[model samples]
Target: MLAGPAWPHSTPPDHGPDMTLDRIAQDLFSALRFYSRLPTPAPADAAELWAAPDMDRIAYAIPLAGAVMGLLGGAVLVLAAWAGLPEFLCATLAFTILVLASGAMHEDGLADTADGWGGGRDAEHRLMIMRDSRLGTFGVTALILSLLLRIGAVMALMAAFSPIQAAFALVAACAASRATGILMLRALPSARKDGASATFGQPSHKAALSCALMAAFIAALLLVPLFGLAAAVSGLALCIAVIYMMAGISRRMLGGQTGDVAGATQQISEIAFLLAVLILA
Candidate 1:
């Protein structure tokens, strides 16, 4: 099972005040540690490995981390297709790598959110349900549907175009979806006084904006080559809409954001982005 989001009990490296290249690189490393199960090199001060990520500082680097993560999956997709695998199998293989690499961290979050929302009678009950490690029927169903939709969409993309094109689409979706999670984190208050989301803390407006801009720029660059400029813009707009709607649901249903809510935001927005591109293509 994917471990829960790691809100480590450590501190940031003293990279000084300026946003130096070293600082940015460190933040990207922090983001990878928090967001994925990839074997990133540990910091020289190993204690920082167990420290809570400075979301405000590292949040802007998340999309960059996501782009790196997605590129790995994309490479697998390309290689599998080159080896003459069917589109369905190629997409599935690539997606499997992505899930394994990330330790299904976001998938776990999506399941928890679905269970909490579907099973709870109120905010407190929902939060309690989310805290339970066991998956409910609702959670299981959500996971199945999410996985199916994502895999099928990738297959469709590959069938319609070359694997290279589909791989870039996946990269764009991954970057934009994770960036939307930052928006959800910024939009809602912490649902509880404790836990990962609360301890990880909200990103500042500047950090959130930086993340959004970078993600959008990256998505546009990759997507425009495959889809027209208009389609690229439309896909991004649809993704933002997904974030807006999810944020509203999170606020009303849970009274705030949890780690699960943020995870669910990423999973769903990724689906929306992929479908938007496919439909517009």
Candidate 2:
């Protein structure tokens, strides 16, 4: 008879505060690998890591990764602009880096959401369309348009402001986008029985809310210097409004939020924040 699945085993644990952070860090690292389609380290190596449910880990990981992306993207923008790179080319490169780093996970969700919302006639049909992995015409168009708009905004900001301002704009976009995802998770019920969102969405609302506020604060701090405190406030209000509107639409069409919907929220919010900064600055 075939042997039962051999689960790897571990011995003696540290159980200290540092160990807890290390566990959280390992979980976040695993999530990044999963989202980015990078190879996962062996369980033996990750044995000290505590299990974080999918939705909870995703909720935590998305924003943390966003912050990292923002820093990297800002560095890219500053360096390219200093190198006398064309604004359009610099923006394009920055966008490319963001996509590559996140593995286009949220962008794919945005496209899927667009296809569902545009092509489906009813809630059931919309959910079905979203569940289907095949890319539709509407999805293709939405992806292209989103990228074009993002590129335009980035290029315009670079042309209008100093490299420091451009860098802050990138950071604002990244933080605000992931903040949108957290807000949706806090507000919407999970739409599917078995999915990442369903697993990760079980975290207490307090935790979700705390993370959301932290993200918003990070974005606001980045924007205030470039756009002034009042402008930053206005920009944050715009971001929240856009995310709430998208959440309502997703609830109506999908019957609730799914991973794709969460991803869609992030992408839309990012664009909204970028536009707000561009207009206000």
lDDT of 1 by residue, 3-22 (tens): 11212233433435988898
Sequence-dependent TM-score of model 1: 0.92
Regions of model 2 farther than 4 Å from truth: 1-31, 34-61
Error of 2 at 102 (Å): 0.6
Clashing pairs in 2: 54-200, 55-199, 55-200, 56-200
Reference-based lDDT, each prediction: 0.86, 0.73
- For each of the candidates, give the backbone clash count: 3, 4
